[model samples]
Target: MLLETSIGAVIRYKSPVSSKEPEFLILKNRRGSWGFPQGHKEHGESELETLKREVREETGIQFLEIMSFIGTIRYSYMKLNGIRSHKEVKFYFATTPIRDIVISYEHASYRWVSFLSGLNFLAHRQLKSILIKGHRTGLY
Candidate 1:
């Protein structure tokens, strides 16, 4: 099986209204699956570099404050060519003050949702776990 690695961010923004919970940004891809901004790593690029680039490219949010490395999620899936591949995704806990999103062509839409809403938007258990971990860290 082939192995692939990806980098992504669990980007959150605290609402200006103190009573509201911090919201996370999730993107809906052309395929209609909702997920954090992520992409395969490129040669010669550091993990942080890939994270920032992918987030910027996907969301057009330029002022990203990457707080820390959250954790990794691993899984396997069958490729289009019928080959099985294992993949690992590294997620960072990041923050952004800007909420005006200009989603890239790769995505169909985007939403800034509360933590619980994020879990509802994401179907993958791994992704939900990542969000829970990030919330527990309280780093942002």
Candidate 2:
């Protein structure tokens, strides 16, 4: 048996020099499924640092602040060789989107979607709930 863990954020921000509200950038994975930018936390990296780096690698934006801690979700599955494995993921609420944008090939595509559209884009119910709650709070 083995265990793995990751940290990421529902990062949001508005384009500078614009009057529009904040928007979130969600990535479509290699499998082309839409979701938040997240990846495994690397060794010797702080939680915030990992969050910052992972988001950058996936979406090319830098986080400005970690607004809130969104707790953790744990799940288990079998590895490729039939080994058992479990993972715990911690999410934080952060705002980014200041820099110019580009999508890395780690995902097939990306979108700067609105709060509601993000819910529609993401497939996971728990992740959707987090986005809805964040939208209601008007925190971007």
Predicted model with the maximum TM-score: 1
Question: What lDDT tens digits, residue by residue, belong to model 2 across residues 21-65?
Answer: 567878888886888877898999988898888887877775467
Q: How close is every model to the real structure, measured as TM-score? A: 0.93, 0.83
Runs in model 1 deviating more than 4 A are: 14-19
Report the lDDT tens digits of candidate 1 across residue range 46-124.
9999998999899998989888999999999999999999999999998888899999999999999988899899989
Task: Provide the clashing-pair count of each candidate structure.
Answer: 0, 0
User: Considering only N, C-alpha and C atoms within 3 Å, which residue pairs clash in candidate 1?
Assistant: none
lDDT of every predicted structure (CA atoms): 0.91, 0.78
| Top candidate (lDDT) | 1
Q: How accurate is candidate 2 locally (lDDT)?
A: 0.78
Please state the error at residue 102 of candidate 1 in Å.
1.4
Model 2 misplacement above 4 A: 17-19, 136-138
Model 2, residue 92: distance off in Å is 1.4
